[model samples]
Each structure stands twice: as C-alpha cells, then as structure tokens.
Target: MSSLSPTSPPPAQSHALLSYPSPSILLVTLNRPLAMNALPFQAHWDLSELWSWFDDSPTLLVAILTGAGSAFCAGQDLKEVQANRLQPPSQPYLKGRPPSGFGGMSQRKGRKPIIAAVNGVAFGGGFEMCLNCDIVIASPRAQFALPEARRGLYASAGGLPRLVHGAGIQIASEIALTGRSISAEEGIRWLFVNRISKSQETLLEEAITLGREIARLSPDAVIATRGGLRDAHEMAGLEETWARTKERYEKKLYGAPNMLEGLAAFMGKREPKWVVSNL
Candidate 1:
C-alpha cells in the first residue's frame, strides 16, 4: 500500500514529495507544479539526503522519480538562483561524501535501480537526472534538453558523462552545443528513452508497475547484476570484462541462497521467498 512520510517530512509542498507506494518501491515527486518542479536550493539538499534514506531503508528496493503537474522538471529554479547570486549555484558534490549528484541520483553509486518517469519538460539538470536512471519512461508530451549552453552555463551535474554514455559523443555534443529540446519520439529513436506513454498519468502508472516487478526480484542478485553491468561497461578489454563478469557471478551471484531458491522454486513449482541483503 502507498504511504507518505510524516516523520521525515520534506521542507515544503513546493519542494518535493516522498512516498512509499508499495512494499519495496519509493516514489519521489518534484512537487513545484507552478515552477515546473524546479530544484531550488532546499530541494537539492533534501534530495541528497533522501537518497541516503533510501539506501538505508531495507523496505525500499526501487525508486520511481517523477514530477507533479504538467512538467517533469525544468531543472534548477533560475529565478531563485538569480535573486541571490550572479551565477548558477555550485554543484552539490562535496570532497568527501556519498556520490549523489543533482537531484541525488545523477552521480550516485548504488545498487538500487531508479527509473525516471519523465512526465513533461526535462531540461538541463532535469535531463541529467533522467540520464542517471537505470531506465527512463517518458510521456509523449515530455521533452528533454541540456540547455546550459543557451544560458552561458554548463551541465556540471553528471550530464556530460551520462549523455555521452547513453546517446554517444556526437549526439551528446550536438545536444549540449545546440541546447535543443528532444521530443519523446526523438528520444526513443535516439535510444535515450526506454518507452513513451500516452499521457503523464499513464507514465507514472507504468513506472510504478515496472518498479514493483523489479522489487520482487532478489535484492542481492539485482545489486550484483547492476554492479557487474556497470563494471563491464567501464572495462576496456573484452576478455578482461568477460573474466570480471565471470568472477562476479561466481563470487556474488552463483551458489548464493537466492540462486538456490530460484532453482528450488522452479523445480517445486512455487514462488521463491528471497532474502534481501546487499553484498
């Protein structure tokens, strides 16, 4: 069942809304509809801390990040930043802290998978956050862009690396250089978006359903699988990557309780009860 957090309440309704919509799924919503769910200073800090909470929570196995109202997110609150500073606020990256970038997930290194439910305009940091997700589901009306170039700024919140990694260097360069918004169809064509929903409401529903399905898997196996995939992506040599994948499977996934449970369940024609743990 869905439940909102009351003990660790967010700053304001305009900042964000955190809720547990299922047994193991966390739904994070950027709540500033009037501001297109822009990330103000407090919102940024809250998101940073919220990721930590999700990491520690044994109940939360998946996260669905989305925005309220018509827009997914319009990136930073420019008006709020302009009122206090001459330039955009500094990246939230600290010298020694958990690696959570803009909106708390961009540069984060963790096992839990996050799915971006892009309901509307996702510009600059918002687009960066979408890139940070393991999967992205966007509405037909949703648009994405790294418009920092147009504003004489740069995407410093893991946008460059994530974009280049997902969309290739050439497309990443063009998007960053032109600051042009990509339609949901174009995003799908470019392989940036996993799928496009008919509308925002359907987008969230699909994302939640997806998150629930993922949450049902063995948590430790999921963690190991995600880490192994990331390592393979970063490895240069094919032989070395294969060796590493084999080693990871043997050490982390193979012969584990979860693996045995799966085999037993299949043989017995029953559902497996997985023990959740992080390796």
Candidate 2:
C-alpha cells in the first residue's frame, strides 16, 4: 500500500468527482451540480474507477456516496444521453475491475461496506445507485423514483434487479411499472432506506457513525459476513448457505486478532482496538 498523501490532485474534470478521507471512511461526492449532478458518460467511467481505487486502498474501510448541491443525483444527463455522441469505451470501465462490483456496488464484492447518503432527490439511475449501497440514510426531504418507464427507457444498469432484491418483488414492480416517486418516509417503510434524517448534516453524521462502528470490527469478519449474506441470498437452500458461512468462519474469521481484541475488550469493559493487517 502507498502512503496517504496529504494533498492529491482532484479527479479528472471529465470525472468531476471529489474523494475525501475521514478516519476509516472514504467520502465520495458527485461534483457536477451545474447539471444537477447528473451523471454523464465520463461520470460512470469515473465512478467505476473510483470504486476500484477504494477497493485497493485498505485504509478506506467504508464509503459514503452522496451528491453535491441539492440533488443526490438527477440520473443520467438526458442531453448527453440523447446526443449519443459519446460512444461507449472500447473496454467496459469495470471490466477486470475488482469484484467489489460497479461503482463499488454492482457485481463487485468487497470486504468494506458502503453507505449511501441520499441528501436529496434520487431518480432513475440515481435511485439504483442508492440500492447498491449496503445501507441507505436519507434526508427527510429526499425523494426516490424510477422514471425510466415514463421516459421510454429502462434502467438496465442494475436498477431493476437491485430494486427487486432490496425492496422485494411487489414494491419493485410498482416503482418500475408506475414510474411513481416515493417519499423518504415511504422509502423507510418499504425498507429501502435504513433511516431518514431531518437534514443532510444529520444524515451524514449518522452515516459516519455507522461507518466508524463497522471500522471498529474485524475486517475479515465483516467481509466474510457480507459475503456469506450475499451468497446465501443467491444460493438455493439454507443448508448450502450455512455450509458456506461455516467454511468462511472456520477458514478465516475464527480466532482472528480482532476477535481476540473484541473478547478482551468485553472482559476489560473498554473499547477494542481492531487491528487489520491488509486494512
């Protein structure tokens, strides 16, 4: 791993994104507010690259994805998409990228967790991005929708599947078919969002607190648990899932240093100092 630089050049302007480090968390913000932080062609590629960067950086235990200005993300920039001038790259940005998935949430699987801070409206692709996160904390004013059906397009980029997986078949179908928007409160009721805050600051604070809590746990354990859950969801029978989970515990997590620290801290009635070699 490389040393953390105090100063680093901003991500390419075409990318127009900002990455800041906070303790064990990486704060990723979409930076093109002029377009309502709408994702352009390059933005998708940049997001893919950013996810890879975070996966490689061991110090970054968690990521908080949010947008700058008023909108969490206004979905793909309509003008850019309609123009069709920007051809897809010869190679997919995420091809051969770490399995932590697209934008770190798609097909990728990683040890670290990601939290989405939906400070404002998340529509279409933006809403899908929120679904990709392990946890979502939304501001009270935030709204979510999948307007692709109304626009004569479909959110094929993990939106349909993730929504079904996260919010279940019925709710996902309603959102996709009707192209209706859901309030932050409704999002919580549907289990799409973990919590709703009164404002952005509170939402972000809650995200940071959750990230810190995750960071304090055994990294291996966290990864294994996440992987197990993901696999279990995909697998057929409970026995198979349990077997895989047992394998992970026996082969990886059991008796780890962090586990020892966790036990010692419990006995000593103090906070544990989690030590992870690979970060």
Candidate 3:
C-alpha cells in the first residue's frame, strides 16, 4: 500500500500520473481524470522514463499500468497535436521512430513483465499501449478500439502490427478498417485480453497477484525464457532457434545460483529464495 508522490524524485512528476513501488511490482497510473486520463505531450515522456526506470530496477520484477479515473486513456491529446506542440522529435513520441516507440511501449526490451489493467476505454494510441503489454486484464466496462482510421489516420504505432499478431490479421483488419470498438467480453473471447473483471480494483488486484507469482520465479530463468520466445518468433525454423537456445541455456542460465537454490528448496521442503541479479 506504499505510494510515491508524482514529484517525489528523479523519474517522478507532479502531474496526474504517478508511480508507486511495491515489493516486486511497480504500479504506474495515468492520473488525469478531467481529460479521461489522456496522454499529453509530457505524459508520453513520463511514460518513457517510467519504462526506462523499470528496466534498470532489479527489485521490480513486473509492472502494472492503469488509469487513475474511469477511463484508461482516451488516446493522444488531439488539442496538443492540432496546436502543433505535442510532437517532440527528441522523444520520438516515445515510439520506435528514433529513440523509443510510442509511449515507450513499442521499443521497450526489458525482461520484467508488464500487465495492462484496462479500467475503461482504450482508444487509438491507448489501445496501442495495451497491445504492447505482455498481459492485459480489463474491467467489464473496458472497451478497446483503434479510432484513428475514422480520423484520417491509422494506428501505426504498433497497434496494427500487434493486433494482427495477437488477434489474427483478419480480425485486426476488421477492427482497424471499421474503427469500431470491442467490448471487454469480446476482447476476452478473441484472447486479446487475458481476463475481464467486475471492476478496476479487481482487475488491478488480479494483475498484482500474477506479477507476484512471476517475481517468485528465478529472475535469470524468467529473462532467458522471454528472450527465447522473442527469438523463436523473430527467426525461422525451430531447429536453428532451439540449437541457439540450448547453447545459451548451458553456457549461461543453467547452474546459476537461482537454479541451485530451486533444487535445494525442493529437497529441503522450504520456500526458495530467488537470488536477484542484473542480466
């Protein structure tokens, strides 16, 4: 239940968004309720900093991102964009433009897991942000859409690509082309969301539970497993990928302190103490 103020320290801000640290999880919130937790120019930068902070934090094994108010995020602040003051070439919109991808979601390569707790509507870039998460849990009122198509643009910041990869090309095409929203139920049905909860509190509780479970595992094993999956997806053929994986497994992760701890804990009937180390 410990909380950190928005303007507390480095990588922290005084705005609506806040970052709170738990034992093994970092909870980041979009705190602008008046604007439905919309992403302002500075908010994007804050997000990038948040991701970077999490990447270097060894105690933080997982992160849970959610909105402060009822709405998760209405997407980019169109007012700022229209005024020509939103885009920062420096941050690259925190996307994969030059530095990181949009909101730092698309280009992040951290080993820690991220879970998106969709409290309400996740539209346009908001939906794209959810797509970047490793897992998504939504409230029953949560709705997802890529409405950029209707506005003469497209959800290019990993939305189209991730949707196609997660929910299949045909379904992603339908959603993008039609600019229609899908309910939490429909999202769960399509496997786009892992779970639908009764409320935001419940959704976050479940996400934190999952995060703690992940934290209990050996950190090295978790990171290596994520790398293996990413490699398998990027490369062709399982033969070559598995060969490379075996080499890394033997030469690196296996026989590590965590592995020995796991074995000893099993033999001694005690809880395993996972040794955290930077990879």
Order candidates by lDDT, high to low.
Answer: 1, 3, 2
Q: Candidate 3 residues 83-175, lDDT tens each?
A: 555454465543323244556675566566788989999998889888878889999899999999899998877678778877898889888
Q: What lDDT score is found at residue 104 in candidate 3?
A: 65
Residue 3, candidate 3: alpha-carbon lDDT: 23
Candidate 2 local accuracy as lDDT? 0.72
Two-way TM-score contest, 1 vs 2, winner: 1
lDDT per residue for candidate 1 within 116-225, as digits (tens), equals 99999999889988887889999989999999989999998888977887789998998899999899998997778999886766888899889878887877777777
TM-score of every model versus the real structure: 0.86, 0.84, 0.87
Looking at model 2, report the run of 10 residues with the lowest lDDT sum: 1-10
Using alpha carbons, what is the TM-score of model 2? 0.84
Q: Which residue pairs show backbone clashes in model 3?
A: 6-13, 94-101, 95-100, 95-101, 95-102, 96-101
Better of 1 and 3 by TM-score: 3
Worst 10 residues of 1 by lDDT: 1-10
